[model samples]
Target: MPHFYFHTENGDCIRDDQGEDLPDVEAAREEAVTVLGEILRYRGAAFWETASFSVIVTDADGRTVVSVTARASDAAPEGWTLQETGE
Candidate 1:
């Protein structure tokens, strides 16, 4: 089992485990992005056009393994910037 840390652009975070059945970093990242989209929708923001989100995958010892950044489409609302820092 691998531990995954999901970090958002707005300072939110969550943790979960990637079981043996699904062991790829990219696969885990995709699932985290999906969860992030749901979080944006719950916050009354646009998941595909207004919200900018990202994820930092880390191992149990807090070592980063991968990062995934997702931004709203090019037609996103004004004043929205898709930037992330601190991996």
Candidate 2:
């Protein structure tokens, strides 16, 4: 099994364990996106304008395995901003 660290641009962090049969990096990337989407929805910002959102997937050795950047849709509203921050 492999442990993956999901770091969000909004400074949220989560850890997930992928089974030994986990797929390739592309599959991991997709999972990361879906996880982030769930987070956004939970925070009531699913339809908000979001840009520069990113996911960093690290292996057990703490090395980056893959990174994914999320972009807003073409119809994103003007003057929208992501409220992610670090404390």
Candidate 3:
């Protein structure tokens, strides 16, 4: 068992002082996705675009094993316009 830490970066750092014991890097990557998914559920769709952040997974010795970065891709069809509602 190896200890893994998840560190979040979005103009600032959120360190995971208490790490989890994951079997390998693959498991750590999966855990990071699940963690980010839960965050997106609360923050909503635009959070990924606005924040442009990464979920960094590190080993016990602080060696980065994987990084998950997200950014919005505006793939709207041509001539599509966003409907604005009165505030």
Candidate 4:
């Protein structure tokens, strides 16, 4: 097993001092996505201010293993109405 650190950056860098032990890089990648989703789920309102967010995963040796990013854009014209998509 290997330890991976999940650092995040929205506007400022947040270092992950406590890392997680997983099987391999693949697992770390999945964890990164989960972490990213959790962040958005909990702090989604304030997230729009940054316009972009990322989860940077690094191994114990300080090597980058995976990186996950999300970007939001709201470029609607004035008085734009939401159309119902017949989903």
Which candidate ranks first by TM-score, i.e. highest?
4
lDDT of the candidates, in the order given? 0.61, 0.62, 0.82, 0.93
Positional deviation of 69 in candidate 1, in angstroms? 3.5
TM per candidate: 0.48, 0.50, 0.74, 0.84
Residue 55 lDDT in candidate 2: 67
Over 4 Å off, model 1: 11-22, 46-51, 71-87
User: What is candidate 2's lDDT per residue for 1-87, written digit by digit as tens?
Assistant: 455666566444444555223456667677777866676667545434444466677766677887766566667578888888998
Model 4 gets an lDDT of: 0.93
Q: How accurate is candidate 2 locally (lDDT)?
A: 0.62
> Residue-wise lDDT of candidate 3 within 1-87, one digit each (tens)?
999999987657789999899988899999999887766677655565575666899999999999887655557757889999999
Candidate 3 weakest ten by summed lDDT: 43-52
**Tens digit per residue, CA lDDT, model 4, 9-75:** 9999899999999998999999999999999999898689998889999999999889999988878
> Could you tell which candidate, 1 or 4, scores higher by TM-score?
4
lDDT minimum window of 10 residues, candidate 4: 71-80
Candidate rank order under lDDT: 4, 3, 2, 1
